[model samples]
Every structure is written in C-alpha cells, then in structure tokens.
Target chain A: MRALCWHGKNDIRYEQVPDPVIEHPRDAIVRVTSCAICGSDLHLYDGFMPGMKSGDIMGHEFMGEIVDVGPGINGKVKVGDRVVVPFTIICGECEQCRRGNFSVCERTNRNKHIADKVFGHSTAGLYGYTHLTGGYPGGQAEYVRVPYADVGPVKVPNGLSDEQVLFLGDIFPTGWQAVVQCDIEPTDTVAIWGAGPVGQFCVRSAILLGAQQVICIDRLPERLAMAEAGGAIPINFEKESVVERLNDLTNGKGPQKCIDAVGLEAHATATIDSMYDRAKQAMMLETDRPHVLREMIYVCRPAGTISVPGVYGGLLDKVPFGMVMNKGLTIRTGQTHVNRWTEDLLGLIEEGQIDPSFVITHRVPLERGPEMYQTFRDKHDGCIKVVLQP
Target chain B: MQNAYGNHSGSSRAHGVARGLGWFSIALGVAEVAAPRALTRALGMDGQESLVRAYGLREIATGSAILRSENPAPWVWGRVAGDALDLATLGAGYRNQNPQQQRNLGLALAAVAGVTAADVWCARALSNGAGQQARLPMRDYRDRSGFPRPPAEMRGAARHLSIPRDMRAPEALQPYRAG
Candidate 1:
C-alpha cells in the first residue's frame, strides 16, 4: 500500500508500506476513498508536537469502504459498508467508554511511547502520526486498519456524497461539541474566536441550534467573509478591537456563549501582546499556560459558558486564574465524543440543514499531501479545507 | 436455549436489582467523597427508600452472576434476596473509598435500576418477536464515482479547490483567477 509518511519536520513523502489487515477481532480494514489534511496535522509537520519520529503515517480525517471485518465486528456493521471512522478508536465496552469518556480509554494507546512506536502517537492513539497517539498508520493511504470498528466507525447514510459526510469524522462533530459544551440557549448570543473550518462550523451550528446572533472574530479577510456568508457577523480583529466590537454589537453586554476554536497557534495583532508567543515561552518552562483561554474569559459575559474545543498540549503556561474565577463562568473542554453524534450530524446533512462541504477549498491526489501540508501551514491562498483522494 | 439453571426469571430480576444497588452504592460513595453535604441531604429522606432502591439494584446485578451459574433460572429468587443483603453490607465499603462517590453512587444506582429494568423489558420484547425491526434510512452512494483525479492542467502544481461563490459571492461574482 502507498501512504504519505512523515519522516521529520517539513519532510513528508508518498511511499509504499505494508498493507493493513484485521489485526484484532474488533478491527475492520478500510480502503481509503477520501482523506483530508487537518489543522492539527500542521503541528506534526512543523515538529511542534513532541514524541514524533521518522516514517509516521499522517492523516486522521477520512471516510472509506469496509473491505474486510474481523470476526468479532458484526451486527453493528458488515463488509461492503461505507463508513466514516472517528479519530479516537475506543473499545465500546471498556471502562472509559462505559463512562462515556472514550478519548482516554485504557485499552487504546494508553502508553503514549509504546503506542507511538507502533502506530505513531503524537497526541493519543491517533492514526498516522508519531507516538502521541499509538502510531497506527493513518488513512492517507490506499488502505488502513480501523480498530474497534463498531464503536469507532459510523456508517455513512445511503444518499449523501462522500465529500458531504467527510468532516463528520472529526471537525464537524468537534465544532458541534464546542457548541454543545457552550450550552447556548435559543435566545442567547454567541461569539466564536476563529473563522477557520471548525470556527465556521461552530457559527453554522450555533445558528442552526437557535442562537439569536453570532459574532465571529478573526484576522483573515477571506475567512471573515466566509463567516459572514454563514450568517455570522464578522469582526476583523486586525482592524478593530474584538472586545470593544463585541460589546458594541451586544449593547454593552458580552456574548452569553464564547468558544475558542483557535488553539495553541492562535494569532494576535500588533496592539495586544501575542498569546501564541507567550504560550511558546510557557511551553519551555513546562507550565500550565492558557493564553487564548484567558482572553476568552476576559471577553465573555459574566456567568457565561465557555467551550474550549481547540487542541492543546498536555502542559501549558501563564494561566490567568483570577479573571476566570471572577467571571463566574462554566468551562467545558475536551476531544469531541464523535461517535455519539456522527449519526445525528449526518441526519442534519441529509435534511440540508448544514452543508460543511462549503468549507472545502482544495482537492488533490494522495501524492501531493506534503505540498498541501506546506500550503496549509503558510495559510496560503485562502485555504480553508483540503481533501486528498487515494 | 435451555439453561443449566432451572428458571432464570427470578435470578435475572435479582441480578438486575443487585447491579442497580452496586451502581447506587458507587454513586453515593462518590457523592459522599466529593460533596458530603449533598450526600447527607439526599439520604435524609424518611426510611431512606432511595438507599433501599439503591440496594435493590446492586442485588439485581449480583443476581446476573448467580443466574449465569448452573441451574441459573430457578435460583434467581434466592439470589435476588442474597444480593439485596450483600449490597447493604457493601454500602459501608463505599464510604471508605470516597464519600463523594458514595453519594453519587446512591443517586446513580437508583437511576440505573430504572434504566436496566427498561432495557430488560425492551430486550424481552425484541426477543419474543413482539417488535418489528425498522430498516434504517441510509443515504445512497452506490452510483457515486470516485473523487476527481488531479487535473492534468495543474499537474505538480498546488491547486486549491475554489471556494463556492454562494459561500461568499465576492462583492461581484467575479471569478478568482489564480495569479
């Protein structure tokens, strides 16, 4: 099988690797049909996410067909089924899964180092990255093994196109989880802190779930315009004060719900101190630092709910505890339980209530994945989402 | 399938009750450890039927294990009674673990039994041919062609997918020609 492997920083290659097969009774082997480069992948490409080594397979967002299923994987799914695999592979009967906390399942990629060596776990038991996830190969290949198929892969509805259902694997559910965490009421106002794909999904989901008004903050004109098209009022932070603009729009009261879709690499204008730079410094000290999270606390309404769906390293620095304490806000943050909502989100897509394919702005062959990584990292040419077909 | 146990009805119910009690104890234990005040208040009710309900659930769970043994079915009634007693005794152990969890366990156990009962009834209905299986309304993708191959015009060149105009519809729908 040919796969795009990450050898080191800025070094990705499309090379041949052994074909993946059903290694476990609960596993299913999927023929990669369509896969995309995620914003998180850029971290691995830049050598920022620790514990990554040579020859790691490099993708997590994908939809595919089940070519073969292990003996134990039956009833819930079968051969010849088209499915979207969740980023987190969990044994549905495990202790963590029983409690609905599938991300930290004891069985899947529990030992970061060992798992990485085998499957490439840069962050968890993720497919196609270094050891943070267990280094199981990624979907950016001709074929890949899907662990815990019943709990991890969702069957794509019969009528929807693959492009339309692709993001349901990660980004769509992630954005939806961000909104769900916010606990937004029908009449409440929302302010999202990014205009990227996840942020745009948050905007669209907020409106669909009945937020009276949604404000999106970002520096990119293209992304801001996209947010506007999604029915959110865009705030160009480079041209205006986000806090001030949000206040003005909300009649001196801040939005009731705020989400930080922009994670560690969040940008800042020349006026305000850059949280990204500060986070990098904190990372050096091995401290608990939350730069954008602090800003979120400052901009949110008193007693408002804040959801942090943006991915972050285990360690952080310079957290603003006083402001969060004084604000009386409720904070919910984590990886999305994608398995819980894939079917429901697919239903919404079928009804035409949401069309996330609107965010996809590039489609390339599997071999061009490395160049696409560079383009996305540089944020060049208004790239929002990139899909690579095998 | 005939079971080694004569009858499983009484034991299954007992097991359900025990499992419910175990969950209850765990919840109460959690609550006791985390929020002692809440735990005391919740357990303050007259005769503590909530606590009894929790115990019943634990017995039901224990009954499942018993029913799985030889002569599973007929032994259910005896196992249920035994499980209830065992749960009451185990509740104290929960206190030693985490008071907060104890309280949470109590609350959780009560809820679990109710849900478990509902699950058992549903399972029975489906098993008895009393319910019809509904075909899932799945999306059709059989005729779908593979993703577009990389255009020959842009071979080796990084070409981005064009953002739909309706998504933003540039001030005028002018085509965004690549430089």
Candidate 2:
C-alpha cells in the first residue's frame, strides 16, 4: 500500500508501505476513501512537534469503508459499513472506557515508549501522527488498520456523505465539546478565542446551543469573515483590543462563557509580548492548563463557565492563579469524547441544524497530503480546512 | 419494675439505654466523617471529585440518605469513583504523579469521607439513638476488584454522559462519501 509519510519537519512524502492487517481481535482494516488535514498536523509541518523520522505516515481525520473486521467483534458494524474512525483508539472495556473517558485508555497505548520509538512521542496512539500515537500507520494511505474498531469506528449514518462526517473524527467534535463545556444557556453571551476550523465549529455550536451573542476573536480576515457569516460577532485583535471590543460589545460586563480554541499556536502582534506569553501558557495547560484558563477567567463574567477543547502537549509554563481564584468560576476541559455524541451530531446534521462543509475551503487528493500540510500550516491561500480524497 | 439486686429498676433501664445511645452516637460520628472521603476516593480524581465535594456539602442541607441502612454510600461513591477508574488503569500520564501527591489526594478524600460519615452518625445518634436499639450501620466495604455503579439512578448522569460534538450534521457528511 502507498501512504503519505512524514520524513522530518516540513518533509512529507507519498511512499509504498506494507499493507495493514487485523493485528488485534478488536482491529478492523479500512480502505481510505477520504481524509483531511488538521491544524495539529501543522505542528509537524512547522517542525514544532518533535521525533518525526523519515517515512512516518500522517493523518487522523478520515472516513472509509470497513474492508475487514477482526474476530470477536460483534457490534452490528460489519463489512461494507461506512465508518468514521476516531483519532483516539480506545478499548471499550477499560477502566477509562467504563466511564466513557477513552482519550486516556490504558490498553490502547500502554507501550508508549515502543510506539513512540516507531512513530513519535508527542502523540499516544494517533493513526498518522507518527510517534505520538503508537506510530500505527495512518489512513493517509490506501489502507490502514483501525485499532479497537468497535469503539473507535463510528458507523456513518446511511444518508450522510463522507465530507460531512470527516471532521467528526477530530475538529468538529472538538469544537462542539468546547461549546458544550462552556455550559452556555439561552441568552448567554460567548466569546471564542480563535476562528480556525475548530474555532468556527465553536462559534456555530455556541449559537446552536442558544447563546444570544457570540463573539469570535481572530486576526485572519478570511476566518473573521467566516465567523461573521456564521452569525458570530467578529473581532480582529490586530485592529482592536479583544478585551476592549468584547467590553464595548457587551457593555463592559464581558462574555458569560469563554472558550479558548486557539491552543498553543495562537497568533500575536509584534508589540504584545502577552500574546506570545499566553501561547506558551496555553501549551502548559496541555497537561495542567493554567494560562489560557487564567485568560478565560479575566474575560468571562463572574460565575460564568470556561471551556477548553484545544489540543495541547504535556509540558507547559507559568499559569495564572490569582484571577481564577477571584472569579468564582467553573472551568471544564478535556479531550472530546467523540463516541458519546457522534450519533446525536449525526442527527443534527441530518436535520440541517449544522452544515460543517462551509469550513472546507480546499479539496485535494491524498497524494497532496504533504503539500496540504504546508499550505494549511502557513494559512496560505486562505486554507481553512483541506479535505483529501484517496 | 424492681431490680433483683435491689437497685432502682428504672435507673438500670435508663443506664442501659444511655450506653446504647453512646455507642450509636459514636458509630454515627465515624460514618459522617468517613462517608465523603470514601465516596470521593472511589470516584477517582476528575471532575467528579469537585461534584462529590459539592454533594458532600449539600448532604448537610438535604440531610443524608446514608442512614437508610440499605448501604447507599457505595452508590454515591460509585457515581464518582467510576468516573476515573478507566483512566487509572490506562496508565494515563496524569496518574503517573509523584507518589506523595497520589497518597495525599487519597488521604484527603478519606478524611473528607470520614468527616461526612461522622456527621451523619452523630446526627442520627442524637436524634434517634435512644428510641431504637438498632445495630450501628456498618460500612459496606466494596471489592475494589469489581467495578461499581449506583444501585439507584445517579443524579447528574445526563451531564456526565455528554459527548464532544465532532460528528457533523448528516447533510455536511456528504464529502466523505464522495468517491
């Protein structure tokens, strides 16, 4: 099989590799039909995520048909069933799984050292993320082995197309989780910190959940425009102070719910050291999120909720504590539990409550996975979301 | 009533009742202090720890359901305990904490539970200790080996059950199906 391999920072290639087989009883082989590049993939493209060697296949967001299923699998998902594979490969019966917390599944990536040896250490058992996710080959290829298929592979609803469900694997659900965690109520006001794909999803979700006003903060004209088109009030931090704009818009009370969808790679201006400092702070929250958390405290109303659904790393820097203590706020954050909500999200899509395709600004072939990674990473050519067909 | 030893029979009965009341009071006190910590520990360290803490405080206002004698502590504890069990087993990096921190959290939870149990025990002993000569409610020791779910419907299960919204609307899903 041919797979797109990550060689080094900004180095990805389409190469021939061994075909994947059912390695475990819970595994399934999926023939890749469509896959997309995530903002996180840009980490490798920009040489930020370490440990990438030559020939590491990269990609996690994908949808495909089940070409084969391992023995002992019987969840009514069978051969020929179209499925969307979740990025986190979790065993359904583990302690983490019993509580529906699959992101940190014990059995999925137990041998992190060995897997990282093969893929990368930044990910646990991601499909194409190199060493980060057990270095298991990714779906940016002709075929890929999906571990814990019964738990990881969500059966695509009958009527939905692959493009609609593609983001379900990561960004869509992540964005949704961000909004959901904000605990937004009817007539509540929300401020999101980015307008990327995940940020856009957060904007739409905040509106869907009945926030009376949604303010999207970003510097990209295209993304800001997208946010406005989606019915969220747009704020360009480059032109105006986000805090001031939010204050002016909300009459100085601040938003009731705040979400930081920007994660570690936040955009900043030349003069403001705080934005760069905040990005570093955002990274620390990857393990113990304190920086963005503190920012949420500053920008949110007292007693309001803050939700963080951005992807983060293990180590981070100084976190703000005094603000969090004073605000008497509720902070909720975690990796998105995609399996729990895929069915309902599918229902909403079918009902036309959300159309996620608006985020897709570019479509390329699987062969261009490497190039898409660069374009999406640089945000060049107004690349918002890139869908790759195999 | 007359005592065989020529002591006042009413005094003997009163003394016996008082001793039983003391024992009941002590038992209640122990339970009140122990209950919250046990429940929190069982739930593991996650969002549930905070929830259990809030519930522990609320138990004072709403009164305790632990005194019902059918062993409701495990159910309450299970709601929180079950939340983190899987993460514990998965070798989650968060669980790879400094051993001291892990132990400290455990001790804190135990202390909280112990305090909760003691409070309940004391209240029960003061109110109903003399009237009923019932056995002190025993702690229902759960087998850590087996997973625990509450016997009754857990409050706030709906909130905990919420999944992240990554899946797209059915109409938006068309692209993936495109060959």
Candidate 3:
C-alpha cells in the first residue's frame, strides 16, 4: 500500500508499505479517498513535536470506504460502508467519553503513561498524530486501521462530496469547538488569530453561533480573504497593532473572545518577544512558543474568554497566569472532540447551513504528499489547505 | 488494533527502554525502602529518611506498573512527574547541605532528570503500541456510498488542489477533542 511516511524534520515521503490488517474486534480499515494536511501536521513536519520515528505513517483528516471490519464491530459499520473516521481513537463506552470528553478516553491510549507524565493524565489516541496521543497510523495511507470502529467512524451521506465533509475529521469540529467553548453571546465581539483552515472555520462557526462581530488576524492575503468571505473583519497583524486595533474596534473593552488559531510555529515579525521565543526554541530551552497565548491574554477584555483551537505541544513559557487571574479571564481549550460534533455538524451540512470546501486551495494525488507537506508548512504558493486523493 | 499499533520501528526500542527503566525503578525503590537511612545520609537529607522511603515505595509502584503493562506509558509518566516533585524537594532543602553533599545531590538530580527524559521517550514510544494489546478479528470489505467520498464517476477526477466546493457539508465529520 502507498502511504505518506515521516522520515525526519521536513522529510515526508510517499512509500509503499505493507497493508493494514484488523488487530481488534472493534476495528475497521478505511481505504482513504480524501485526506488533508492539517496546520497541526506541520508541527510534526517541522520537528517541533517529539516522539516521531522514521517511517511513521502521517495524516488524520480523511474519509473513505470501509475496506474491512473486525468481528467485534457488531455491524455498527461493515464492509462497503463509507465513513469518516474521527482523528480520535475511542471506546464510546468510557466514562470520559460518555461525558463528552472524548479526547481523554481511557480505553484508546494504551500507552497512558506517556501523557500521564507530561500532562498528569493521558489523552485519547489520535490517528497519525504524535505519540503523546495514541500512535494510530493516520489516514494518509491507502488503508488505515481504525480502532473502536463502533464509536469513532461517522457515516456520511451520499449526496455530499469528500471535500465538504473531510474537515469533520479534525479542523471543522476543531473550529466549531473552539468557538462554542468560548461561550459566545449574540452581542459579543470575537477576535481570532490566524486565518488558516481552522481559523476560517472558526470565523464561519462563530458567525453561525451568533457572534455580532468576528475579527480574524493574519498576514496571508488569501487566508484573510477567506476570513472575509466567511464574514469576518480581517486584521493584518504585521501591518496593524493588534492590541490597539482590537481595543479601538471594541471601544477599549478588547474582544469578548480571543481565539489562538495559530499555535506553536507562529511567526514573529521583528517583535521582541517573538524574537526571544525563536531564540529559546532554537536553543531547545522551550518546546512551545506561546506568543499567541500571551497576546490573547494581553488583548482580551477582563473576564472575557480565551480559546485555543490551534495545536501546541509541550510546556508553555512564562504564561501570564498573574494577569489571567487578576483579570478573571477563563481559559478554555483541548483537542477537538471529532465525533462529538459529527452528527450535529452533519445535520447542519445536510441542511445547507454551511459548505466547508472553500478552505481547500489545492488538491493533489497522495503521491504528492511530501512536497505538499512542504507547501503547506511553508505557506507557499497561496496554499491554505491541501487535500490528497489516495 | 494491531494494525493501529504495529509496524513502527521505534516500538521495540521504546519497550526495551521501558522494561529496563522498570527494573531499575524496582531496584531504586527497594534501596529506598531497605536502606533509607544510608541513602539519606549519602544525599544529606538531614535524617529525613522516612520521606525517601515513601518515595522509594512510589518508585516501586511505578516500576511495577511499567513491568506489568504492555504499554507502560501511564506508569513511566508517573516517574517523570515524580522526578519534578523529587527535584522540587531537593531544591527546597539545598541550603542545608555541605558543598560535597550538595554536589552529590546535584549529580543525583541530574541523573534523575536524564532518566526522566528517557522514560518520557520510552513511554511515548510505547504509545505506538509496540508491546500493547490492540488486536481484533478481521473481515474483507467492498464499498459503500457516502459524503466522505465523491461519486463513483467523480473518483480520481480531481484537479490539483481543487474540489466540488459547491456541495453542502459532507456526510461525515468526526471530532478529535472529546474522547
């Protein structure tokens, strides 16, 4: 089978590997038809995250037909059933899962000790993500073995195209979750950092959820355009003082909700803090650059919510806990609970409330994954999202 | 489940490290439990040997979990967490030690920190399920129609970075946050 494999920092390849076979009763195998390179995947590609080995399969956002199933699947899914496997690998029956905290599912991450040590607990297994999450082979391959099939894979309607639903696997819900978690009120003003795929989704979702104003921050012209297309007020962070602009826009109250759609690899444009973050990251003194985190807190209205939909790994450096506490701000974040919103989001999709395909700027064969990985990571050639057909 | 966990090259190396750390943890735990006074004296703990003994028991428990579980992620993770507490306690009492004793304690802490990194690495490697149970029975599959896939006629008809954006939302969307 052909799959995208990680070789090292910035080294991804399309290689032929052995086909996947079911190893558990509740597992299913999907022949990937459509998959996308997530902004988070760049963390691995850039070697910002750890625990990746050469030849590890890569990808998480995907949807396709079930090529095989395990006996334990119990007919919840079967051969020939087209499905979109959630990035999370879960046992739907766990207490955490029952409570809607699917990202912390106990049954999926067999190697709980890793996350336990880092985070004081384990997170749910994720497909083709990092070892911190479960190291399930991602959906970028010709075939991927999906564990907990009864729980994670959502059935798709025949009328919709792969592009419309693929983000449901990760970014769509991530954007949706990022917004709703902010506890939005109709009269509130929301400010989002980054206009990438997830940020765009947040723009759309925030508007859909009733925010009166949505402001998106980014330097990329195309992404800013998309954010505008999604009905957001665009702010070029490089050209404008975000704090001043946000303050001026909101009558000095700042934004009621601030979202960090850009995560660890956020670029610094000659700013002193970003320069220091870059220096520290290069020296291995810090694992993550929390510039956005600090920026969010700095500009958020007192008692406003700060939401992170972006993917950050390892420790945050010098977080402004004092400021957060003094201002009574609430911090809300987590990996997107991919399955939790699948049904409702699907219903929204079915009702024509949204179309998610506008985020895709490029579609290539699975063979082009390695280069496209670079394309997406470098943000070159006007690329915002890349979907691959395997 | 095997398909999910298997075939990664790092798995065995990680499991090996996990196992070694497990045995090492047991040995350290036993020492703490059996020779708490001597250990304390060596580290200049000021006769607080009982605390060392408690920590030793914790090491033993962590080691036991690493040894018993096929994927020792949770257990080894505990040791990494413990290392912080251990370091914090050591640092808190640094003013009480003689120069030589302080050096010895520093070396011990450094060693623990290094081991913590390795333990974290190994635990992470195990997250790929090298020695873990992830098996399920298999059956062949054919095909089905759904939103995740374009129609049969449209399959492989995609343009470079282009899609049918005009369609409604996809048939399936999965979340990764709520496990």
Interface DockQ per candidate: 0.01, 0.01, 0.01
lDDT of 3 by residue, B29-131 (tens): 9899999988778788867888999999999888777765635788888888988888888877777789988998898888878987887787677765533
Model 1, span A1-390: residue lDDT tens: 898998987899999989987888988999989999988787788766776768778899988899998999766788899999888877777676776666666677745566445434422367765565676788898898998887788888768888899999889988887876665555678899888888988877776665778888887777887777766788987677888998998899888889988886665212334533432444475422355676778888877778888877656555666777887777778777777667677777776656678788778889978777866775544567889999
Model 1: per-residue Cα lDDT over B85-120, one tens digit each: 544644554554356656766775665455445444
Candidate 2 regions exceeding 4 Å error are: A112-124, A130-132, A268-271, A274-294, B1-179
Better of 1 and 3 by lDDT: 3
Which candidate, 2 or 3, would have the higher TM-score against the true structure? 3
Model 1 reproduced share of reference interface contacts: 0.00
Write candidate 3's Cα lDDT for A1-390 as tens digits.
999999999899999998999998888889888999989889999899887878889998899999889999888998998888888887988898987788889879866888789889888998888777767788898899999898799999889999888888989889988887776665679999998889988887777776778899997666787777667788987677989999999998899889999998877422557656765776789888888899999999887889888888877788899999998787778887777778878877876667788677788889988878866775655678899999
C-alpha RMSD between model 3 and the true structure: 17.2
For candidate 3, the per-residue lDDT at A319 reads 88
Q: How far is B81's C-alpha from truth in model 3 (Å)?
A: 53
Q: Model 1 Cα displacement at B138 (Å)?
A: 39
Number of the top DockQ candidate: 3
User: What's model 3's lDDT at A83?
Assistant: 88
